[model samples]
Target: MRHLVVPFALNALRRGRSIEQFLGAAGTPEAPGIRWAELRPTAEGFALVVHLAQDIGGEGSYDLVEFPSFEREDGEEDFGCQIAVVDEPLAALTIAEKRLGAGRDRWVNQGMAGDEYRDYVRAGRPPCLSASQSEAECPET
Candidate 1:
């Protein structure tokens, strides 16, 4: 995992200060379990996109996971896992999750972006989240 995580500092933000390096992992990019995931820059923070099977009896599609990020005094962040895939465009959707992770999560048809997503994130590249996930936390030269 070190080979893949040496670049991003998400762990820093995900669990506060994370200096430990993952040295063991077993899989190739060609592996079947390798799901497609990408980070999207949003005005407030970032969103995740992954291509995978939708659900039971459902075909695969791009699932966007938008976890509400909240920082704690202990340095651990809450990654609200409420997952869902807006069948239509992001703009035309509204998502709501139950508190304490109970009940079913729902989304309504609505537009999230009036024009585009960048219009929300200050119009430039988002700053590095943390040192572990810092843009500069790269491997040795």
Candidate 2:
């Protein structure tokens, strides 16, 4: 799985080696998706940027997603901000993962042109809720 390669990529970035990873098939404007993620070492830590699958008339583009601050196992708090340099390679990759995860349900996840999407659309695009119907769902924002 692609997840297994993430740690090695992070290690390479931490060693000052910029890395680019192709995440999924290219997408369209109607449903933008993450094409690749770039990691560049920085003075503060590192910068993570992702190329959007759909470009503007063939021109390349990038987008960043905000990740909520999470408590670290050591009891430290993360900044929980987007487009900010991260202090650790794993942290930067974590942000990139969060960005990639945002589009986890897009058609690209299935394939370049998988028929499963048609069935999903016909099925009313049911969501993968965190809790079952028997359990309380997260309150609406």
Candidate 3:
């Protein structure tokens, strides 16, 4: 997909979290106005769903993105610049930091964007991507 995603999701997942729970869990460094990022693995790579839980006076919607991972000529992982916005949710989207779980395997979506993040109370959703955080990574996909 081609959606813009905040970097907190990857950072928080590295810390053993699905969606970041505490404000400081993944809000450091840039401190996005909005919070929460969910990552799901795809057969070719992975998918990311970011929720902008808009306030009473704002608009809330789901932005989706995908990254196709591959191996380079040297046998090393080469996630090319092929970030595209996928229509599919990859998995159930969730805003709960704690319930979102961590990334699959050691891969985490690493990218940055915060101008879109807005304020919010909370959102409803699945228990996180803990069921299978196995294989995928997107560099700001």
Most TM-score-accurate candidate: 2
RMSD of 3: 14.7
Q: What is the C-alpha lDDT profile of model 3 across 15-97, one tens digit per residue?
A: 44433111112112242222334444345333444332222222243231122223334675442222233333322233222
lDDT assessment of candidate 3: 0.30
Of the pair 1 and 3, which is ahead by TM-score?
3
Q: Give per-model TM-scores.
A: 0.19, 0.41, 0.21
Weakest 10 consecutive residues of candidate 3 by summed lDDT: 20-29
lDDT of 2 at 123: 49
Clash number for every model? 13, 0, 11
1-141 in candidate 1: lDDT tens per residue? 222232233333233221111111112234311111222333433333322211111112212123223333468553322233333222111221111111111111112211112221233312221122111111232
Candidate 1 vs candidate 2, lDDT winner: 2
lDDT of each: 0.23, 0.41, 0.30
**Model 1 segments more than 4 A misplaced:** 11-34, 53-141
